[model samples]
Target: MTPEQILPSPQRRQTYWHTALALAVLAAVVWLARRHWPMVETGAVRLAVADQGWLLVAGVATVATWPCSAFAQQGAVPDRLPPGRLVAAQFAASAANHVLPAGLGAGVVTLRFLMRCGIPFAGAATAIAVKGTAGGIVRGALIAMLVAVCPGVLLVPSLDARYLVAVCVAAVGALALLAGPLSDRCRRALTALRAYLGAVHARPVRAAALWGGSLAFVALHCVALVAVTRAVDLPLPPARVALLHLAASTVAALLPTPGGLGSLDVALALALTAAGAPAVAAASAVLGYRLLTVWLPLIPGLVVLGVLVRRGSL
Candidate 1:
């Protein structure tokens, strides 16, 4: 048989390997969870999520974060994708992220959505990177501030050390952001981001409103987390909890795992324990929080994505 007749195409090979890797990783996580399931406190998990107020707050935060994040992502694409279309694309991508293993399936789906909306591949790629990376920068700054304001937070052991690392990283990262060519690179990566902000720059009143709205959106999620921790009555102090959140989220963002699922859980558990909370309680709270914050929005996002697609808005 000729080579062409005997061999699979390169695209098929790529797809096969990617699927295999994803399956392997999923199987490993399942096995690990099953093996260690006994260590988790099922009862605690149940109790933590029962607080209606906290759950409501978490939902609000998750939704609010989307728009602020979308704003951050705005200018990254060229005019190929309109703002409304990009929003639909983001929602669709987020929906895919929850169902797809390894977390990148959603990103790929989103990239395709952008392309469909007329964004160049290069611009889409850069925008995704910036949109994701900017959150880390914000978290790192928050952690550094915490370290200075509440040095006692360092006593949390696992978290304190991470806070220190974030402080250093933030300093270096900020310097890089400010560096001339690097700043320009980031600007190019977020073309829409620049356009949106610049268009409003002259109107200080409007600019202030945008900044305030964005800040409120980001803060709501953090507040929700804090509220959940309190609702569960976890032993950790509020300051320490905030620090842990900053560190865990930053680390999770860097993690290769989809949505930082397993990694975020482990980090939260450790941070809680280190801050002197009972292991089972911490596990339960973290699990409950993830369900509310991550899995909950996922359902609606999927539906929205479908709507967008059907309407040809995505």
Candidate 2:
């Protein structure tokens, strides 16, 4: 082989190592967490999952979120890929998030899968970017509304000042991105984003649909959280539970720990305690939610990835 052909490209090597390191981290976290599984499972958990009715509702909610989330991502695409294939890609991506660190595995997998399906990397990236951006937007709006509408309910004295300051800083940053010279910068960013989407799909409506779908998908996730809490007979109000869910989920996404495994549990527990839920209940609720959502998706996603690779699609 030619010298150039024999050597791995730096970019490809970096991607390979990045994926390998991420997978290793995810596996280690999963192993450690499993060792503590018994501690996480208490009598309350049995009682919680025993509510077959609500558990079923939660399952449906989780499943429904997948497609909606996929659509939101699809919205960022300029045109639509085949719906069946797109859905499969989303499921596979879901699986990646379950097994990988910081939820990046799935995003990487999604980008690759779509690219193999003849989508441009730029468009696929844009679609993913839009989905992520939309999620941030949704969460920010929710947090702001909570602070405004239920100040007493959510405003802990210790956190309130920090929270407000953070919001102000974020607002200023957002404003800078949206106006004056920043407006041109914003357009450039969006234009780049659009280019990525175009690489996947050229149709605007399809991209919009995906974005909308992604939002609905996230909303379904929140519903699943509510359902899990109800199944456990937790007495937390729905709105309160939703807010906690949002906070924990966002934090989990930010965490470098695989699938936000440890971070997710801790975040949920803290959010619950902060909101005044009993410790045991908070832990159980978080555990139950992760069981249905995170752990459940990994195996299938890996399987799909294998299948796609075998089919020469990824």
| Clash statistics: count for each candidate | 3, 18
Task: Give the per-residue lDDT digits (tens) of candidate 1, residues 263-312.
Answer: 67777777778778877777777876787667877778888888877876
Prediction 2 TM-score vs. true: 0.75
Candidate 1 regions with alpha-carbon error over 4 angstroms = 1-32, 35-41, 75-86, 100-103, 152-218
Residue pairs in collision within model 1: 75-191, 75-192, 75-193
Per-residue lDDT of 71-135 in model 2, one digit per residue for the tens? 77667665556677677777877777766656677788778877876777766676677778777
- Alpha carbon deviation, residue 134, candidate 1 (Å): 2.6
Global local distance difference test of model 1:
0.66
In order, candidate lDDTs are 0.66, 0.72
Strongest candidate by lDDT: 2
> Worst 10-residue stretch by lDDT in candidate 1?
72-81
Model 2 CA deviation exceeding 4 Å by range: 1-39, 43-49, 156-191, 194-204
